[model samples]
Target: MTTAVITFSPQGLKVMQRIASHMAVDQYLHQAIAAPPGVTPFERVVALTGEIFSRYEGLVYVAPCGVVVRAIAPLVDSKLRDPAVVCLDVGARHAMSVLSGHEGGANDLAIAVANITGAEPVISTTTEAVKDLIVGIGCRKGKSAADIVTAVTTALAGLELPLERVRLLATADVKAQEAGLLEAAAQLNIPLRVIDSDLIRHSTRPFGHSEFVASHVQLPAVSEPAALLAGRRTSLLLQKTAFNGITVAIARENCPSLA
Candidate 1:
């Protein structure tokens, strides 16, 4: 599905560009706001939204939730037919599924944006919110996508978990640009969260330390820390496991009731 990111303010435009830089998405900026090349500028949000409401499969608004709600209020229809709408703060702090959370693929889009921007995905769907599996991966440079997939699938299979249960695949931002990692995520149809190195370094949660990782990536550990930090109320369901040049860890996010 085609996606577009739109914003009104300069700060929001920066966030929009950050997302668009990683994902294959179009950009729409308010006419009054200045932007770099490749971003289409529009006169009014309401008019622009109407024009592209049906044109794109996904719409990410890098503005306040109220602004997005107001712009798309009139265009909302059935979830089956409407495009997925995600609301993101201008700071790129949270990606919320504002419309058609489940049926329209907004939930997935929210997670994808969050994964790319190191933002939190605000998914309110009961089933999704309660979801437990997070797979964190760390691989040597230039590993094949097939190798990464095989290692992840093997790790999940050891615990008899299905692929659908794996909501997020997280890795340090240092590995975020790896083509193999990105392709594995695309092949699995899951979001690959790129956690900042500083966040991992400063995380309160305890994880195993790897001297090699500390030397190269400047982090204590990659897979374990990434798994534990990706979601809310998380705990390590499975510790880091190695296969060939890849290391994988699994973390489970507890539901509110469970917590």
Candidate 2:
């Protein structure tokens, strides 16, 4: 596994260096004093830092406050492909697991580093790590929106749920209009329903039901709306409309009551 340490302050850089040296893993360690152009310092760090460890399988890191850590948060959330993210205070007195700690060996690394540096390791991804159901899907690079829809459709079908009983769909609105999604819905005899953002906002039923399945499709930045909808029984379909990504949640209706 390769690790990239991004920091702006000299003191923070030194702390990262010590951790890297102590770990003694065959990892790439790179330091940047300044953020790149046209990007926030955080985004720059994530982009540059990501490149350094691209050749390796895993990533470990000590991100200090400032642009570097903030910008990388979303990218790490969306991309990074299961990379381990750990944050360190300026003096290396405390370490926190902010991302990918459980599955990516970040917890073990935190313990090791804490023992050596005498820093307290704070882990936050405990629930996700234990349950491990938050799966990420990546569309093939440079693939067309149509292709992405096909892939997602095929993947959803493999889950093997009855197409008619599904309801409660969620996704970016733009994906609701994609040719691939429409086609898949027609072929599968499902409804590609649109979700209103406000519903997902003020509702306690985020997960809807165990029978409910969610799909996220990428979309173009300007043409998407974050939306969610619930119904008693309706099949749901998701297709990627653009590059920004969308999430669809499908639920099965309860049996009709005859009073």
Candidate 3:
């Protein structure tokens, strides 16, 4: 989905530019969407917003809510088909998902934007409050996507959790190149978040470790700390389970504060 980040002022444009820089580097971590125009091409807010509503899948409006709402009022349509819209204050203090919070991907976009701008994300989606489950996975270098799906789905079933409850799939940064893991997440329609291995190894809570894993990844474990780090939880819903060549761990939390 293409993201159109529209700024109303020079300061807002500057902040959006900074966000664009991070987006470039993190493209692989998250699906890369088209970069927003460097500068706001249209001088008029209403015209720009109408054009965005017509053209983009996502909209990042770096301006006051009132301004954004007024500009896009005429374009408002059914939530089922409307584009996801996020509003960030010109000061970059808060990122709020203004429309299509879940199905349209606005909530995740708000969090992503907040991650870049150090802004507090105001996520009000009901599912976000209730469905905060993170699945952590680790596997051999050449595991198949089907193997990953089987391992993860079996774990979730044992825990009595539905797939829709999953908010993200996490793994160590070193495994960012792991094709099986990426394909599994893509198949399941879950966002894959890669956490730095240092942070995982230095986690406050002890994780299940192994000498073999240490020899390979320099860390005793991957899924546990990766899940804890991504979920911001102190405990796991399901301990590490290994089958064939894949390992899966489950973590649960209720919309923990973003890092």
Who wins the lDDT comparison? Answer: 1
- Model 3, 167-230: lDDT tens per residue? 8788887787798888898898776766767676777777788787899989879888878777
- In model 1, the Cα lDDT at residue 126 comes to 74
> Which pairs of residues clash in candidate 1, taking residues 3 or more apart in a chain or in different chains?
none
The runs of at least 3 residues in candidate 3 whose Cα sits more than 4 Å from the true structure, single-residue gaps closed, are 7-47, 62-74, 87-96, 107-123, 196-198, 210-220, 232-234, 254-259
| TM-score, model 2 to reference | 0.38
- Compared with the true structure, the alpha-carbon lDDT of candidate 3 equals 0.77
Ranked by TM-score, top first: 1, 3, 2
For residues 1-259, what per-residue lDDT tens digits would candidate 1 score against the true structure? Answer: 7999999989988898889888899999988887689999999999999999999999999998998999999999898989999999988889999888888899889988987787888888776655678999999999999999999999999999888878789999899889999999999987787788889999989789999889988889999999999888788978999999999999988866756
Question: What does the lDDT read for residue 100 in candidate 2?
Answer: 62
Worst 10 residues of 3 by lDDT: 25-34
Measured with C-alpha atoms, the lDDT of residue 174 in candidate 2 is: 33
lDDT pick, better of 1 and 3: 1
